[model samples]
Target: MIFTGRGRTRFLDAVTDFETAVRERDGDRAQRAMQQIQRHFGDAEDDQLAQVGPRLAALLPEVPPGPRGMVAVLIGACVERGADAAVCAPYVFDGLAEALGVAGEFCERWAATGGGDFPAPDPDAADGDVLERVGQDAADGWFTLPQWEMASVAMLNRPAVRTALEPALRTGLLDALRAVQEASGHDFKCLRYALVVLDDEPLLALHRPTGTGYLLRMTGIGDNFQLHTLLADVLIGGGHVPGQAPSAQEAAVCRNAPGQVPTTGAFNLVTPGGEWVWNEGTPTDIPVVDDVRLLVLDPPPYKRGWPAGRFFPGMPGDLVLERVLGADETREWLERCAPPK
Candidate 1:
């Protein structure tokens, strides 16, 4: 199960390549490096995979904030493919959990005990409805919620925000609801939603009260995928409840919300011509186009690949969008808009 010095060197080289590609915003090269890293782990014996936890933990601090999620994905893939409960508990799961500054005890217990079931839901409980409904919707293959409401919930439910304010109400229901209202910032309140009822365009909306409101429109496909996962996590009780921010060391390596970055207020706008606008707030007066390729309203900031200030040779929004929309079209659009380089 022990990794040979040579094997370790190869793995580290792959990680370095992956990190470099990410920094350079080379999508194809980054993807190739990731696949190589996956193959390296895929070749490992289960016990050797168990040894990977500390190695990953060691590497985590070295990884810049931008690519830490990719590292998490690599680790998760390795564990899912090879590591067992015993192998995962102390090494992989606990290490990641601790780094995130959230309680790892639940995950550690589940891994050690080989329990796959999430916490049991209480139907009679008022506080359980959001989780229960979200879980059911996900299982049913349809998750629908008012976009603004969902954004509010996700922002308020963020671990850092929750930890900062201790509401007087002990009931989870009131506390979460209060958090939602309080978390809805001034800009969000100025917005209004007009639901598009077309069978072909479920979840489509025209937001209003500003010329820039059309930017809030959602694609039924791209957006729902992100929302479904976020909601399902809350339902399953996977995230940490609010508490004091993690220590500097923990926050440095923690993937959850390092530096407690505000999760609300950012919007992603995609034009029919493939131009993307990533704005900190709603942009006004965008001209109507043939078709809007995509619009993600108030996407959780942490999910957007690291905070703004932490990374070098910053990855462009176009490159990030290319990961979602593919390279050929993205490149074509960029070429059309190309400035002297």
Candidate 2:
């Protein structure tokens, strides 16, 4: 359900006011304008509202209450104004489950599966048996589905949103970007970003995707590859394609270290020596230090080797190492690294 160029333009143009309102701390106007945008986008569904309302009410008793109304509002807007099922379903389902007194674990599982209507759990079923069934199903590959693709806005024309932010399901490129941002004590959001992957197999190639100011693409040997391959592919893939993103050329080549070449499953801490490890192996297992003079500490698949340290062919390679550190250390580092405003 990609949005048309006009639709995308409308959204971006309309959102200017909303973003500015948020930035200006005009909560009243911002919230109202957001709601107006939702309605303008045709998100005011009475049935969805009705379904969500009672469900929320029923769960109020058992739950420790906080901002239930806020939850409802968010859910309502997501359903009415959301761009795709991937983006909206999780938010709506998670919210409703909280309001309906559903177990947190169950809700999470349901979101992962993109659940549909289901009968209530049988009271008589053994708890262990239920657990065993779910486990068996997972072991049998129930959870192993094809990697879903989020299409471009020019392709979105349906009632619901097509591509949305899935915080719970980030790709390798996202992880890499996050790592660098975390280590550098800078906001990744301040930079335009993108991820793209060129698959080993033709069918697995990442189709060009259009995004808002940033893009992240990934390719795999198909979905059946080991977890490491998928992660590495995504990171490398992102490095390959910067899309319409700003400073894309720099972001793409920044991570290519010499001996610390990026692999598919390496963990890099952008510290003094370019600390590297396999996330599946050990957190503290620093394999090589000073292997690469400079490191690109984007997110996941922080692989090994430091071959071509630059993305573009002619760029000079600076030996900048990026890493992920603990919260306290990160704060300390940020304080030291702070530049004059």
Among the numbered candidates, top lDDT falls to 1
**TM-scores of all predicted structures:** 0.22, 0.19
Native-vs-model 1 lDDT?
Answer: 0.33
Tens digit per residue, CA lDDT, model 2, 1-341: 24443544454344456556655766676566555445444432444433433443333232222323333343333333332334334433333323222232333444455545322332233245444534433211111110001111111212122234343432533454344334323332211111221221111111112111111222211111122233333444445433222132333343332221332233233323333323332111222222311212334332343321222222122211122234454344333321211
Output the number of the TM-score-best candidate.
Answer: 1
For candidate 1, the TM-score is 0.22
Cα-based lDDT at residue 149, candidate 1: 28
Q: Give one digit per residue, the lDDT tens place, for model 1 in 260-335.
A: 2322222333333334443322222122333433332223334343222111111100101111223454344334
Worst 10 residues of 1 by lDDT: 312-321
Candidate 1, superposed: residue stretches over 4 Å from native: 1-35, 81-341
